[model samples]
Structures are given as C-alpha cells and as structure tokens.
Target: MGTTSNSSLRSAGSITDVAGIEVGHFTDTRRPTGCSVVIVRDAAVAGVDVRGAAPGTRETDLLSPTNLVDRVHAVLLAGGSAWGLDAAGGVMRWLEAQGVGMEVGLAKLPLVPAAVLFDLFLGDSTIRPDAAAGYAACEAASVHAPAQGCVGAGAGAAIGKVFGIDRAMKGGIGTASVTVDGVTVGALVACNALGDVIDPDTGRVIAGSRTPDGKSLFDTRRSLLRGEAPKPLITGTNTTIGVVATDAVITKAQATRVATMSHDGLARSINPVHTMSDGDTMFALGTGKSGKTLGMMTLGTMAAEVTAMAVVRAIRAARGVTAGGLYLPAVSDL
Candidate 1:
C-alpha cells in the first residue's frame, strides 16, 4: 500500500498540492453561527454522496450520473441548523450574477453544489447565517489558505455530548492533502462527532468528551456496563461534512467511490462514527488537471487516509472558550 502517513507535513495552512481550490468563511461570533464556501477550479467535475441516517443536503441532483459530465463551479457549506438551507439561495444569486450556472437557451445558469449541517441548538435559535453571509463568504474566497476552527460552518460545532454541553468539547473545520503518483488528492472536514477523537497511532484521546470541571473526557464503558441507561439528553445532533478534491480525471461513479473511501478517514479519527446522532457526509471533485491514470479503489483508499488526517487537524486546531462560567477547549489546544 502507498504510504498514508502525513505527520511530516505540518503547517498551519491549506495543503499545497490541491491547487485551484479556494475556501472562504463568513462567521458570526456574537451569535455562534456562520457559513463557508469552497470554490473548486473555475469549472471542475464533481460528485457527491450522503450516508448519514439524518442529513441536510442541497443541490444533490447536480451530482447525478447524468450531471457528472458538466463542470461544477462551487460548493457552499453553511450553518443555521436546518434553516440554514436559505444560505444556498444567496450563493445562487451571486453565481447567477456571474453567469456561473447551467446554460439554457441564451441564458447561462450557475451550477453551485452545496451542503449544510445543524448548529442552531448551540446558541440563539433566532440568529443564523443569512443570504448576505453566503455572499460574503463567496466574496472572500482567494488562492490563499482560509481560516479554520470556530470559523465558517464550524462556528457553533461541539462534540462529546452523550451528557449534553457539560461534556461536549470544541470541534471545527480541518483539511489535509497528499500526492499519489503525481496526482494530488486533498480533503477538508468539519468535525462534530458524538464520541471523542482518538489518535489511532498513539492510543491517546486528542479531543472529545469533557468533564464539567474542564478536564479530559474519558470512556464511559464502565458506567454503561452497570446497567444504567445512557443519559437521555439532546446531544446526538452532530455531523461531519467534507470535500475530497483531486486533479485526476474520474467518472461520477469513481467520485462516489472516493467519497466512500473518505469516510474511512472519519472512522479512524472519530470513535463510534456514523451513529444515529452524527450525520457524516463527504463529497468528491475532480479538477481534471493531473494526467496520471489509476484505479478507482486505489484513489478511494488514499482519499480515506487524507480525510482522516484532515479531521484530526480540525480537532487539534480548535480554540477553547468559556460560556456560562464553563471553559470549552478549542481544537488548537487539543
């Protein structure tokens, strides 16, 4: 197998191999909500898949097998609980103004794919990232690496909630990339797992459940074995969404396979993932830049490894904050 480890490439910025893809965020710290936009190459081939039992997806039809041949211009990741779906409307408006969508007769429509995760339960339900925020995020996109952690869609993200906010830890967005046979495959994830994040290689808990006293969160297996029912709390509404971008040419089917492989990264970095509480999802985009040829399965596996690394980075980049006299650790401290 090709080497999947990326410990040697440590820098506080986006991966260098995945070129032409830009990221931007519009955050609302006062309200604990925000949105992000990931702009692939001006026109790239893209595909998507949603495996979570409960997911909030938008513009999925654009990734259908028939739609795969067309070029995908952009993707939007937003916050507002389920209500955040409106953010896409703003993106559409901007794209339409730029003539970035599908063509119909004499008119050119913008084809922007988007996805969303829930964050309303974190703060004031009344406040959310509106259409204006979506436009702002898109306007901020550039070639440089974008900010991570409690910025963008991850602004209100939290984890380790089998016992509510008392045990939840700070979670946010992260990214990683790798070169395979001269082809670059990169991944970015917004982590909000129900369980804690573990460093699989070291057997250490990097992030996850926390104590009310602001200490490391630990396994609660012993408490469960005692025949006590798990805490009946509203802590299961979490999800992790990501995108896998590659320069290699691939079909929609291949893109879907890459997405499935990316989930492997999630399983490695997060404990008890794909659970009813977590709505984990992944997307794949082909930039059509690399000339190398490879099997779909091979790319899938590599995508998974990169995805896992990105998720860990997201956790490690979080920043701890205090709320209601309680201190919450951010990914940066992990």
Candidate 2:
C-alpha cells in the first residue's frame, strides 16, 4: 500500500483496473491446457524478469531497456510447456489484424513477449495450446477482470510437484488491483510452482503438496527440512508466470526494476519458488494513463504486494479436477 492522497483502495480486484489493459483467455476443453493474453493496446512500455532456470520465453530480449522496442502490445502466458510459446504467433496475428504494433518501414510488427508453463503431464500432451488458441484468447479480450482459476494459462497449472503429481494440487490464474494516489497498480498471475502455496496474510500453508491420505497439506518446506525426500525433478515441469501493470508513468528501466522486485510476491506466497525445474517469469507494464507518478520504491513495493495478493487469490480460487483417472484436488477440495 502506497501513501495516496485518497487513502482508499479501488475494488475492481483484477489487473484490468490499470488503464489501457484488457485480459482474455482461451482454454482447451479436452484438457487443462490453454493461454491467457494481457493486451496493453495503448502501447505500454514493458520490461521482464526471468528467475526460473528452465524458462520457455519469446521476444524477451527485445523488452530489455537496451533493446530498440519501447513497448509491447501484449504479454501472453500459456500452458503447454515449450510448445505453448507458439501461442504468441496467434496473438501477433490478432494484433496485426487490428493494426497494432510498431511501424518499421512498410511493416507493422506487433511485439508480443510470451512465457510458458508445463502442463503437459495432464491428459494428452499433444493437445497443447497453439496459434489458434492464442488468437481465440485475444478475440475474447475484455476490460473486465476475466475469469480466474482453472482457466486460461492456469488451466493445467499445479503445485506440490516436488512430491510428484499424485501429491500435487491444482494451481491457476488470479488477479488483483490497488489504487494508490490515483494511480492503479494491478497484478495477474498464473501460479504453477514446484512447492507449496502459502497465505501471505496468514503465513500458513493454503495449498500444495499433500499427505499420503490427500487429506492434509505436507507443508513442503518443513517436510524437506525434516528429511522427507522430494521426488526427482524434470526440468520445465513447473513455473509461475504473470504480469504487473500500473497507470503510473515510468521509464523502461524502472519497469524492469518493478518486474524484478515483484518476485518477492512469489517468494512470499510460494515456498521454494524459482527452483531449477520452474520457469518463473514476470513482466511489468506502464500505461502512463493516470498522469501520475510514484517513487520507484513505493511503486515497486506496491507491485510486489499486489502480486502476492494475486498469487494467494489464485490458490484460493482454484477448483478441483478429475480427468482420465487423474484427480488433482484444489484448495476447496481439501
């Protein structure tokens, strides 16, 4: 929470509260695999941070402050492991159809940076998200908060993978927003981690690895410290990807800083986050629509808080699923 003249928080409760932001999702009904799009149609300056060692990303180098691209049309988060990166092409096509992008020579290139999380373990791996799924997500874009949990990029996400899928619980997308001093800071997260999900406010395990009976949480961190053996990890099996946005005016470097600091949110919510098998990535966007500003410290701090809120929301909102004889329980189920 930043010191705002108004001192009251606006309650849209999603990242869309940030001006010029829209969210859309495309979920494959056959299985929990799909993508979500965050459209910054007004050309928001963007930056990114990749903390997980096994990441699947596209166009991220261009988002660096040193790069030529100053802004991005959209950020795509998808479920399908590395294959999901193809969804970015669909987003590009959708944006090009609407004539959105940077004009270089005779071509308008819609800059869309994307990240993918592994959900291939669920159901049919071959039926992953594709370009059509990406375009369909953009087609469903809306100014509303968009559906959360068990949808879009979060569809196939799961946590507690440190003990394998049998002990894992469902993870999904969540979002939240806070207005500070007339500037709105919002976060959207698709949380699929290789650890337990904790409640930042309560400092307690909310979801994640479960006991053998599947009736209680194992508290993964404590278990590991107490000598419980974690299953062998396959690279790229887990990841948490998302975006943080604000209406405050900020430079590309500052945006990058925000993205970096926002990782604290994941640290707060996920025990043992940013592991080798996970590919955690976050992007920061500045729409500058509020015509307002906050100090880098305050803005970055607020982004982290909002991001944590979104992560917790993701766990709380997730729904249990049973498909193909595989049952992945959600918070509600336990």
Candidate 3:
C-alpha cells in the first residue's frame, strides 16, 4: 500500500488527514457530471447507512457486519441518478489493474461500495458518469486536500428543491477533519438536498431555495410549515451522500453505528433531510492506523460534528451558476 503525506494535508483539515487515505475528483467539462473517489489502497473496515426511501446505491449489503467482506478498497460518490452507479465498475477495474482486491482463485475482485446523486438535470442528461470517468478520478487521486466546491460529483449539485430546481441553489463538495486524543476523524460530503442548507451553529439558512425572484434565501422548512411551497414529490431526484473516516480501530458494526450517528450532522446542517424524495446515504471507514482508543459514543459524536462542518464548507466553497434561464446561487451570493 502507498502512503500519503499528511504534513500538508492536515493543515487543510481534509479527510486525507486519516492516514493511508487519498481523495480524487473527475469533473466532466462537456457537462456538469463527474465522480469523486476515496481510495483506501490498503483497505479498511467499512460500513454504510442508507437513510432515505429512494436511494441509488451499490454494494451496501456487503458492508453488513455479518457479511464476509469487511475490507474495502474505495468508495465512490457520483452524480447521474441511477445510471451513475455504473461508475463504480470503473473504480473496481482500476483497483484490480493495480493488483488490489480480494483473492478469488486467479482473480481479485475489488469491493467498491458506491452511491449516486441526481445531477442529470443540470446538463445534457445523456452524458452521465461512466467507467472512464471513474478511472480518471482514480488517476487524479492525491494525498493532499482535494479541490472542493463545484467539481467532482458536486459539480451540478442543487439543494432546496422543494419548489423544484428553478428556485434551488448550488450545492457542492466539502471536507473537514477533527483530531481527538491522537485519533483523527474526517468527513467529505457532496450535498444535494431537497431542503435548505443551514448553518447549524447559527440556525440560519445558508444556500437554499430562493424566492420566486431568486434573490433571497427561502427557508424550505418555514415554507413547508406555512404551506407556501407544496408540490408533488419526485422520487429519486434528490440525495446527499458522503463519507466519514477515522484512524481508530473499530469493528464493522461499530463503523455502521458511526455512519448512522453521522446523520445527526446532516440533520443539523440541512433543514429537511431523508425525505421520500431524497436518497441520503453515509459511509464510514476505519483505517485503524492511529492505535488510539476511544469509546463508541465519543467516536460517533465526533463523526456527526465533522460531518456538519463539511456540509457548511460545501456551501461556503460552492460557486454559483446560471443556465437555461435557471440561476443557482451559492452562499456567497446570498
């Protein structure tokens, strides 16, 4: 396994701060579609939590504690609706090419669990993420903090779609890490929600649906409560996906608990999440390199804290965009 440099990476407070982990992105220039990869070349114990009713996922069942496969090579978050799940194949292929994977007779099958968000509506829907794009993301893998904001799977991400996309704001990728007693826990999130992105610290809407004039933030939760914006739900059209990694050793079941608790961060950051229309998914990876000890309660709480921080970073780092008479603004614009 190749080791990555944390000397500079830690300064950026990125997920790469977790030892032996690398992050990469591949954004399609022709359209706002791409994939992000978290390469754990040495493999790590992994767990996942699918909290939404409509999810576009791959290999989540294998992450169960009872399952035989516990070591994971990489995790992929992408944009393209269900079709985007195909990109995971490319990740697996790349790992196999590098002689990485579980030995199965003469072949080594890489275990790559993935999740996808809906960005197909952002550009030409015909052009979605493919195998080549995933491979490119692998090629771009770096131990340094990756370029966040409007890139990778978050390039075309939109949030606060309670009134559909016309009033939605730009959503993107962000990362943050926290160190506790020598154990480091980090998070990377691609935010594309059906509700507003709020700053949990202040309880203010950050990047979210704008008013009809598209000038000010329209708190989605408030709108729904006041019966202002009510529309039929569009299943499988929205999602927020991310990964939380730690250097502490943990069992697969413990990792699953970490992932589940991370949702507290999502709930705090987003006004309304895990709706029938949203496919919110979270993954937790334990690299077990720190040789540090922490109780499950402490670890899970820190997971949620970092996850929320990353969500705020995604909106703050995001850049606005305008296309086809639709204007999606970032937090800066608000």
Candidate 4:
C-alpha cells in the first residue's frame, strides 16, 4: 500500500497521500452544454446511496451489495438533465471493448455506474450530453486527472435561489483529501446545492445565494419566515454528486456505509441540504490496497469530513458566468 507521513498532510489545494485515484472529465461548452466523467480510482470497489426526495438519478440498482459485479471501473457524472442518462451507454461500450465487465458464457458485460444532474440552462431543452459525448469522455479518461470548477457536471451548475436565479451562485467540481494514521481518503464533489456552501469550521457562507451586487445569498428559512412567496421556478434544479476514494480495504457493503456517511459532510458544508429541490447523491470507492484497519463508524466519520472538504473545494474553485443579465461568479471568484 502507498503511504505518506501524517505530519506532512495538508488540506489546502489538493491533500497529500491520496493515491491510485484518478479523475477525468469531458466538457461541452455549448448552450445547455456541460461536462462528464469523474473516474474515482482504477478498478475500484464502489457503491452508492441517494437521499433526495426529488432525485433524478440513474444506475442506482447496480450498487447493490449482492450484485455479481464486485467492482466498477468508472463513474460518469454529467449534465444533460434526464435525457443525458443515455451517455452511460457509451461508457458501457468503451468498457466492453476494454474487457472490463461481468463475464457471461460467451461475452463480457460492462458494469459502468453513472449519475447525472439537470442543467436545462433556462429551458434550452435541446442541450444535454449524448452517447457520443460519453464516448468522448471515456477517451479523455485516458489522460491526466480532471480539472475542477465550471467543468464536467459543474459546467452549467449554479446554487442558491430558493428565490430566483438573481441570487444563484456559481458552483462546480471541487476535490480534497485527508490522511489519518497513514491512510488517505479523498473526496470530489459536483456541488449544486440549494443552500449556500459554508465553511463548517467557521460557519461562514463561502458560496450559495447572492444578490445581484454580489452580496449574501438569501437564506431559505429566513425568506419563508418573512412570508415571501415560494418561487417554484426551475432555479434550484441542481444535484451535487461525486465519489469518495481511498486505498483502504473495503467491501461493497462498507463502501455503501461510506457513501451514506458522506452525506453528513454535505450537511455540514451546505445549508439546508438534501432538500426536495436538490437531487443529492454520493458514491464511495475502495482501491483495496491500504492495509489499514478502521471501524465502520470511524470510516464513516472520515467520509463525512472528506465529503465536506470536497464540497468546499468545488465552491472555491468555481468561476462566474453571465446569465440573464446577471453575473454569476463562482464562490472563489467572489
């Protein structure tokens, strides 16, 4: 197993000691355009758990612990609304060619897991990633690790606005890692939170709802208490999704536990998370090389921290976009 000293670990930028995990993205900048693919680790044991009431998810059934496929070669996070789910077919095709899939009598079946978020981009409806785009993403996965912020699933992602887009903030993909006793666990998130992204340690809003002048994003609770009419606008059509990868030896069941625990990190970093307007989902992947021993609950707690850190990283790495005469800047850009 790869190891790094605890004393040398850092939280800013990319954390140290996170090994074997690789990320890749394919982005289309056209209107209703977005990004795809966030491979956590090569040949990873993976699982998923969803906690949103109005989630628009796909491939969740494959995460079951009893599934014959014990490992997932890649995960695709893309923007194309529900229609974009078709992108996974391309990934499946690629994996089939690589001989990475479930083996039957005569042929191998690909077991690529995928998830998506709706970025309709003001109802341009025609916009979304297709099978070709998915293939492009798979091709891109062959290169260096992914680039965060305003890319991939986050390309058209925005946050805030229980009110309207005027208060939405730019949110994208962010990553962070931590090491404990020589074991490294890292997280990457595609943040599209309904609530503002906050620094858990400081309780300060780093991103989320913001005024046109680039002021504080509105608080949903405060707005409700003020008797403001609830805007059912498509403003909060967001979903934050990503993976937690570690070198630790973990089973699919344990990975499921890690995915469940990671939600706490979302709750910590984003206010009023797991809301109806948000299709929040998380995945966990174990690379099966870190010979560290950890209790299920302890690993869960670590997952939460790493998840929160990844959310913050995504917010901080975001960039501004001009939409509807409004300048929506990323959390860090502001």
Choose the strongest candidate by TM-score: 2
Model 3 RMSD in angstroms = 3.5
The local distance difference test score of model 1 is 0.72
Better candidate number, 1 or 2, judged by lDDT: 2
Residue 164, model 2: lDDT of: 80
Each model's lDDT comes to 0.72, 0.91, 0.88, 0.72
The candidate maximizing lDDT is 2
- The candidate with the higher lDDT, 1 or 3, is 3
Tell me the tens digit of each residue's lDDT in model 3 across 308-331. 988888988999887545678888
**Candidate 4, position 90, lDDT:** 82
Candidate 1 wrongly placed segments (more than 4 Å):
1-16, 66-70, 220-228, 233-236, 323-327, 331-334
Provide the lowest-lDDT 10-residue window in model 2: 1-10
In model 2, where do residues sit more than 4 Å from their true spots? 1-12
Instruction: Estimate the TM-score of every prediction.
Output: 0.88, 0.97, 0.95, 0.88
Candidate 2: tens digits of C-alpha lDDT, residues 1-334: 3225444443437898888999999999999889999998779999999999999999899988998877999999999998999999999999999999988889888999999999987898889999999999999999988888999999999999888888999999999888777888899999999989988878899999999998999999999999999999888899999999999999999999999999999999999999998899999999999998899888887888888989888888899987666789999898
What is the lDDT, from 0 to 100, of the residue 231 in candidate 1?
57
Model 3 regions more than 4 Å off: 1-12
Off by over 4 Å in 4: 1-10, 13-19, 40-42, 142-145, 212-214, 221-229, 233-236, 323-326
TM-score for candidate 2, residues paired by index: 0.97
